[model samples]
Target: RRLKKKHFVIECDPLVHEGFESTARHVEIPYLPMLVPPTKWKGYDKGGHLFLPSYVMRTHGVKDQKEAIKSVPRKQLRKVFEALDILGGTKWRVNRRVHDVVETIWSRGGGIAGLVDKGNIPLPEQPETEDPDEIQKWKWSVKKTKKANRELHAERCDTELKLSVARKMREEDGFYYPHNLDFRGRAYPMHPHLSHLGSDLCRGVLEYAEGRPLGKSGLRWLKIHLANKYGGGIEKLSHESKLTFVEDHLPDIFDSAANPVDGNCWWINAEDPFQCLAACMDLSNALESSSPHGAVSHLPIHQDGSCNGLQHYAALGRDYMGAAAVNLVPGEKPADIYSEIAARVLDVVREDSMKDPATDPSVPLAKVLVDEVSLLPAPLCLNQEIFFFMYLFFNKTVEDLDIGSLQVDRKLVKQTVMTSVYGVTFIGARQQIMKRLQEKGHITDDKLLYDVSCYATRVTLDALGQMFQSARAIMAWLGDCAKMIASKNQPVRWTSPVGLPVVQPYKKYKNYMIRTSLQCLALRREGDAIATQRQKAAFPPNFVHSLDSSHMMMTAITCKEAGLHFAGVHDSFWVHACDVDKMNQILREQFVELYSMPILENLLEEFQTLFPTVEFPPCPAQGNFDVREVLTSTYFFN
Candidate 1:
């Protein structure tokens, strides 16, 4: 067993082979071959144990391995060193087997030196130092950029504030200095883009002045004379000087003056557009007309000079108009009457809980009249159009409740529209009179006429409040209603019959047209409504104009029509004018004349072809047929 185990532990040895070419009679290849003897070193050099190849170590017991060295060419040995340089000294190791393999390949066709050259590893470029002054300059530039950004933000904020103040002042006071108006009395120097802008300004002023006291006469005066002054457009005003007459008295005169012709009075008139001279003369005459006792006795001049001074003051009002009087004299004390008025104005603006509150105290003093007047109610009572509209809208709101039909809840409608906040307040104040009338059994619904006036007052106040940014937020709520519907996929119903859908992108085109029309109406361009009517009239005989630029109800109808069309339905309006016979005749003729459908049967056939599931039902030819019922039902269904 010992002998067998020993035999299995036998020695191992590498295989070797040798070959010789047979000598030919005559052949010599022109090639030079050279042998390179391997070189090796072995010793301890900080790294431990050393070993070397046979030719390198040259030990007596080793066989002649010089043949292996002789097999490789001398040129290949240099290539090994070239590869060593690329592989880096740290990773390279010289061994007989590895050297032989490299050498054989290099000698036959390839060289390690070629790979090293191809790598072409480059030395890094040196970094340059920046000059101290240049570094400082860059730092300064960075600081400037930051500062500029802050300044730009500040400027934007200021512009926003200015715009807000300007819009508010425009809506509230209507105090505008016509910049384009030529004091020289000829044509203005510049042509304004918005021709009606001047009219808007004048209207704003008259509206502010009239407030609750506004009458039809006043409104008519504005309509006639608004564009006559200021050359029919918003004119630029020089902001250089202050005018006392304009700031202190123009608003009062506008309110109190009566038209010599028909007692119609407004803020400004074409006859005396810039007549501060005439206004001061009027004030002087009034002062002179008063019994000179209570406060006028200490006058410095006679009543005659007072009147003449009034004229002089009016004529010389340019000095004040062009200077610090627009706000106030620079060094005026807070306790001064002007300063006191300013303070009061600020207090009033702050205390106002209405839509727009004045946040800035530095508003021009001239606008105080507007600020005060806007807090009041309007005068004119609710007319049929406005009352009916609000009634319809409110009535539509309660349609979900069990009722006989979708007829308007007149009581709720009147309560919401006519019995508004101001109306209620007025009613509360006049409770005694109402109670007495009720006890006498003489209190009719007509007693609410006063409430109509109260409602108008509230509406006018609300309209003026819109000039203030805060009051206009009500519009945002109304605006969001559209957005809320748009965010939904289906129609939203407040009441069963009053279904509204969200706005869709496809419907938005027609919606935009309607909105544009309404905006034009609000701007008082009567031609827009007429133009739209003309366009619709071009379509068909039954095309009773359903879209009205001035009627909000009609606009809503248009929106609904567009929405229904997008929802895969078509709707049309034909009041009493389109009776059964007229509609049938029109439909027959429309299809035949327009697209050659001579009879109802022909139209029905075409419709069935278009919509295969549609079915037409038999009906009495004598009875009037509702087109809406037929269109929405299976009358023409295939």
Candidate 2:
């Protein structure tokens, strides 16, 4: 038995066989092979532990920045370091634009290094740093990089804030500075962007500013013109200096002042476009001695510069014309407000909310002004229940109950809503309102903080961090969705519905799909990474937006059929004030035509083809469509 046990427990031995190739006597030879080994994956170091592969970093949002920086060839790396030596380490105020890109990238660590390392682009030459101060400057440069980055973000916020305040002051208090006005005597040197970017859409009656208390409530010091008398973009002034305008007794003068005509000759002002148009009607009425067709209507749509317009790009229709987008939202804040309002006005009774909100009568009254004097049309008033937004769009809480459909929930409506239903222009002001509401200790909830947190997302957080950094768990869940969808394919590339190819950030480095990042699928936490996959989930909405742009572009082309000179910023259009009625008519018609197309179905069909085997979640609320529901709301575009 012992012998048998020993035999069974025998030691394992390797079976090795060696074969020798017969030497060929006279071989027509191939070239001699070099001593290079086979290619292997280049992995990058991340936060400690095992290094992450560049594929994982690119395919996921987790940037292996250290490895990325190291991946740069030594020659290029030295150039970037040299550029930083010139810029005081990280000061954005640079004398030469040549070194800006490289110095900026170097300061931030990695991102653009691959661009230079590949010899795709050479770093612009800047004056060499030879000063004794250069040594100490660069030593602290990397240390101060984080702070400098923060300052850059702060500077962006300041720009937005200044633009907001300038829009308000321009509307509320016209600076007599002659330089501010452009060739047509309109506000010149405006930011390339539009006004009230963070506010809700300015949907209101165009006829009356009579009883409208007409301005943001607490911009206390904007009653006077700029003290310098050199009217330029608000960026020209310091933050402290910009806020010190005289606020007592100036709104009337500002209103009475000549409104500037923009490039399109549209009347730019603080009032909603609808309100301005009505005001133009009154002005035309006053100017015309003769009645046309005896309609008893007169208002000259001439130049006036008091109003501030939005650069909005909302698409609601179906086909080329987007006819089905019965409800349209232009800017971000406006979209949020109108989305809430739509939830209310379109609300319907439900057994566990089974009824479609679109069935309610309040829908028509939702965005339309009750009368000319009203400031807001009818934005949904928040109560303790709906006090906070669930997210930027389509997020909802259980407290957002069915009473909104009843239209009789005035008791549920809070007093924060003013009698005049004007749109919110400054998101900061809007946040202040929310904070004030929270302080009252009535409806305060975590959603308010979450909503506040989302503001950072709007300002553009780090490309990789955006997914994991969502304030709400749902956003993270959505990030997971993005991951799943994006993981199915490598060398992933998709074009917008209108043809703008979705460029990968990896392209920013190598200018090509390196396939280096797709190996992320092999990672242990393959399910968790989403930074790179955000575009996947965003595809549907982004495609719709592209269609919106397409529809608008075609609409601009089509509008020529009616002798109109039209210019649009996405969903919103600007024309001479006199053309307001005509523009609205054409816009409504064009929207109807666009919606008439089967845009949503087409998009879904494309989605199904791309994600054939993979089971995706049910269609999101943003993409769910009902042309019947849309056809009834003329105020949708407004």
What are the lDDT figures for the candidates, one per model?
0.23, 0.30
lDDT tens digits by residue: candidate 2, 1-638? 45642222443231210010111112222211111211222222221112222121222342333334345454433322221121111101111111232233333432231211111122233337877687566655554664554454343333333333333333321111100111111111112222211221111111111111212211111111121111212211232333332122123223322232212212222223323323333333333435322222222122111111111111222111121221342221112222232233223211213433488433233222111221212343332213232211233321232224322222222221211011222353345434543553433356644453233222212211221121122223333444555676431233333322332222122122333532212223323233354444443333334444544545444555565444444445544333444555565555556556544445445555667775645432333334343234423443
What is the C-alpha local distance difference test score of candidate 2? 0.30
Residue-by-residue lDDT tens digits, candidate 1, 249-355: 34444443433222333333323232222232233333344431221110000000111111111112222221121111222211112122223333343344233
Could you tell me the lDDT of residue 201 within candidate 1?
20
Worst 10 residues of 1 by lDDT: 297-306
Once fitted onto the true fold, the runs of candidate 1 whose alpha carbons sit more than 4 angstroms away are 1-194, 197-483, 489-638
Error of 1 at 354 (Å): 20
Taking all chains together, the TM-score of candidate 1 against the true structure is 0.14
lDDT score, candidate 2, position 244: 35
Off by over 4 Å in 2: 1-484, 489-500, 503-533, 604-632
